[model samples]
Target: MTSVSEGRIHGGAVPLITRGPLRTTLRAGDGVRIEAVYEPCTAGAAAADGAAGAGTAIVLAHGFTGSADRPAVRRAAEVFAQRAAVVTFSFRGHGGSGGRSTVGDREVLDLAAAVAWARSLGHRRIVTAGFSMGGSVVLRHGALYTAPGVREEGGGRTEAHGEAHADAVVSVSAPARWFYRGTAPMRRLHWMVTRPTGRLVGRYGFRTRIDRRPWDPVPLSPVEAAGRIAPAPLLIVHGDRDPYFPLDHPRTLAEAAGGAAELWLEPGMGHAENAADESLLTRISDWATAR
Candidate 1:
């Protein structure tokens, strides 16, 4: 789980200068209630873009152990709000939402629900951008549900499934596969997600309850799913110095995506949303808007 206050603060002027995030909830694939908020783009952005970006929206998925209010998450949202509408949500179990964390598997449903809400609000061009685990979820979500009239996962997993889409996707510091513990940070994370005592610590110490169940059949790896995001451009961003995944994760995903994806291995970056640079975030915002 991500620490709540470790990074720079954002949304300081949220209620005063900018409109507060409109609150809402949507049931995920397994019917777990997911907490979510949609922040309208800063006033006059539609006019400034000559309304080209009017139908566009950006959905942000925070990292493991993170909630919508985490400073880094909020900062990214605030920065994006200056460009277009922003939707940020705590994947089930991470914040004011029901259910336990499935790490990155069931979180795909949470991202789906958020994307559905964005589309329901009439945003025709939606981009799903996530950090770390959330980044992996966005990739899977985009791959699984990019087109309508296609069969996707359903039954008990979520009430409403499929049809949600990410016209463009930006995955920041996400791993290519599961059970990665090569780095010290990831080793600690594996401990937190796999052990009972570690889960207790997660529940009390980090406010995250990682599910103990192993992935049933194992969900599609991010590298595998990257192939499906073609036609719809994919951006794989990783820090060259990322403690959790190093450079290979992004390389694998980019190779899977082939020419349909672009990769940016940041020079001095670390891991996930919290460690992402502001310039990188702005570049993501620009990418989403252009798509």
Candidate 2:
């Protein structure tokens, strides 16, 4: 359970001034206080059960070099919160969390903490949704805990962190595999992770705390993880116009997922949650809610 005494939401909302997000630091097992916010649905939905108009809740994971406060992340949270209670958190090393990001490797612990916090708050049906790096985390985290007690390969080093019983999973603009430097954006990303100058830029400019070391064993690939999210529905959303990984990445994940996953490729989109148009977000909101 998330400890309120240890980490509490900083401020309360004034009646007419602002409906601030309910902010708290969710404590990860390794002692990282993952900065998180539980945003109830719009006022209309707030009046309904579980503040979602339904029992389902959405947990959104931001992209690489992004935190919860990023405009793109907030926009997605705002849209999704219209249909379901949205839980948005900064992965360890991003925003207010403590730790250097191992990029996609140890981030699963961050997501697991948020998911467990949502469950503790009485959200029964949880939808694990992520963008880019966070998207890959969602896929691997799902595969890690098909059963609550039996820990699997992808849950990082620790034991079964939490029961990865997401009712639905959505991956937006995620990479199928790591160390992919095929595109200009990815090449730049590699530099940011592997070089000192890039690390400095990531730390100061982007506020993304990237680790110096590479994945030793290398965590499970998104395509490999996608295959394990069976029985629990998976939605793979990618952009045909993405600069990072092309449509082939999504196709690979979709192929691994077989019939359990639905692949949607947008025509004029760029990457991650930032490029997700309102119409597409609406469809996503509907899909998560309906299922």
lDDT for each of the candidates? 0.78, 0.79
Please list all clashing residue pairs in model 1, or write none if there are none.
1-65, 2-65, 28-158, 29-157, 29-158, 30-156, 30-157, 30-158
Error of 1 at 67 (Å): 0.4
lDDT of 1: 0.78
Q: What alpha-carbon RMSD in Å does predicted model 1 have with respect to the real structure? A: 7.0
What TM-score, to 2 decimals, does candidate 1 have?
0.87
Instruction: List, residue by residue over 1-291, the lDDT tens digit for candidate 2.
Output: 111111121222222212346777766655667888888767453536444336677899999888888898899988888888788999978998888888887787778778776666666678899999999999987776454554454443233334335778999999999889999999999999999999999999999888887677778789999998877889999999999999899999999998789999989998998889888887888889888
lDDT of 1 at 259: 78
TM-score of each: 0.87, 0.87
Best by TM-score: 1
